[model samples]
Target: MLKITHNTISEYLSNRTFSSIEKIQKENNNKKYLLLLSFLLLLFIVVQFLPWTQNIQAKGEIVSRFPDQGPQTVQTIIGGRIEKWYVKEGDQIKKGDTLVFLSEVKSEYFDPNLIQRTQEQLNAKDLSIGAYENKVSAIENQARALEQALIIKKNQTQNKLVQAKNKIEIENAELQNINKNNQIAQNQYQRIRSLYQKGLKTLSELQEKELKYQETLAKVSIQQNKLNNAQNEYYNLELELSAIERDYSEKIAKANSDKQSALSQSLEGRAESAKLRSSVSNYSQRQKMYYVTAPQDGYVSSLISTGIGQTLKEGEEIARIVPDKNNIVAQFKLSPQDIPLVSKEGKVRMRFDGWPSLVISGWPETSTGVFEGHVIAIDQFLTSDGYYRVLVQPNDKYKPWPIELRMGTGTQGFFLLKTVPVWYEIWRQLNGFPADYYREDSPETKKK
Candidate 1:
């Protein structure tokens, strides 16, 4: 066991066993080689200490910041060949702008598997609706009959009420006649009584007068009873009229309820039929209005399946539309290794293709016409290409990109990662290091 002090190591290197190394050094220590070697070492050390903000450069494009409902993909309504193109790509169009026309297609002439099946189904549905129409008509007729019967019953009730009034009036007249005869008999009895007392009238005559008065009184009592009976019968007739009214009302209500149920059923059938009819009508109209129109005001961003004579199947995509100006965003793609370094704090330097600009790495002062942007968000997952899609917005501190900046223009982004010793990043990249700049415990990771 031995402890090798610094002096001991130096002395060992100076020994004759290391004399071969010493000799080689002495022979090759020419002034030019020594000078060149010293200069390279100095340069490497200086570069390692220089302020190097890691800049991740990725080729990207200027993309529109379309709203949730902005961009749309137009598709063909039927299987047909393109007859003509009314507008080309990059054309600014208003809503309902004609883009391309498709040739006419019908079930009889052009019967694809899907189109033929759909047409047959529509025909079957139309036929099925006839039964519902019959049901509706039958229900309506029943309702009408009930309504007419109710009217007739009401008229009969009114007639009965009038008859009861007439009977009451006749009975009242008979009662008055009986009352007049009773008064006349009372007067005759008085006169006869006076004469008999004077012996000028016979006893039989007086008795006869008394009997006549009694008969008249009896007739009055009988007639009064008849009047009371007639009045009771009149009330009873009124009750009958009320009962008839209630009975008819219930019948009419029931009939109306049944009719409504039938009508609702009919309407349900008709609603579905209307939907199918509209679909068929739209297809027919589309045959004449063959041109596919834009759903919104926008520029024709791109055309994929649109050309004269190109066949388009039903619902096949034709082109992509970029909605109106004002919403613009820059999309920068970054490698997984650079993901940890890209966040809200990261800076973006973009050069829109049409806008002439030069990005001077690490020297922002020398950059020319470059649009400055900031990282708004970074996708949580890598795309199919193993790159993260980073959303960028124009930096408020610097000048914004021109309003004329078009979507899908070529762009070069300089995503400024954290500033570190230039040598640290160089060494990490050389060794194929993973992203480790942002820690899980940091605010950035927690926020995400």
Candidate 2:
């Protein structure tokens, strides 16, 4: 009986041990399931926070940066049919470079009468200039000749004046002789009269003495007339001298005035000549328009859009130039919300897609080096594609960029956005409004 009881107890003990092992195994399996669930929950929480944590910068709007480009170009000055083209598209040009030749045809609508009138006016100006020149020359010659004659006449008058003075001296001497003779004749007549009174002379002798005295008086009178004539002749010569001197002075003054007038006329002639020369030069340049030359050193591009022998009007477009094909930029699209951040003078930081780790900061560059630029403009109006485009400018100063940035290159780029409060997103969501709707309107509307 003791051996049987021992056997039963041993079996029961073994059973109990087996059951405990099963319970332990079940607990281990449950703990493992719980642990797996906990790990999954933790992973989900971490994944939700990954985007926020990766970029801690305040969330705002993303925008595009538009860059400055080369100067704008146009084609025609005055409307005409293109005769020839000096350069095709993609040709570089300097200032004052000729690009195209235009055939200028006389306007069919122009009035023939007006043309005739202009021609008549030009002919009249020519004739007037010639006539004025001839008149000025003739007046000048006449003045010179008159001046010489006046000088000669003045000298001759001076000599005549001297001769008249000599004649006056001679007449005065003759008058003095006549006066002496008259005085002697008067003494004789007085003595004859006294003798007649004293009966010492006869009547015939007294009469003869009186007649001699009268004759002496007549001679003295003639001498006096001669002296008066000499004086008058001298005075006339002086007057003539004075007149000639006045005339000479006047003629000389006129001659000098004519010289000045002639000089002025010559200046007018020079001005006219210059005007004609300028007109002729302009016409000649127009005629040379038939031949077009390369304005600068550059490669000729295909005339894809515009062709030669095409009629164009004023301010028309003929061709374009790709100064350096190696100069290229990436063009991308942005949302309307990005407009404000990318202003005309705002700075841009760019990085090509698929290479974010290698960021092109401060400025987007084409291969020569990192280039600096500012935002130029933005298209507020949405395009048909619902995406607004942004333009990037490569550094033009660093020409001949690497092969990757050539004109016909494919590039990808991204524009940086301005930062704002993180709560603004929640606010916009709650209000059923866009993130930038408030900014789009005035301050009063923002509050509303």
Best by TM-score: 2
For each candidate, what is the lDDT? Answer: 0.78, 0.60
**Clashes by residue pair, model 2:** none
| TM, every model | 0.46, 0.53
Per-residue lDDT tens digits of candidate 1, residues 160-220? Answer: 7788788889889998998999999989998999999999899999999999999999999
Writing each residue's lDDT as its tens digit, candidate 2 over 50-88 gives: 321001111112222222232234445556777766665
- Which parts of model 1 have CA positions greater than 4 angstroms off? 1-45, 56-74, 78-99, 102-288, 293-313, 317-337, 349-373, 382-387, 393-414, 422-448
TM-score of 2: 0.53
Q: What's the residue-level lDDT of 41 in candidate 1? A: 100
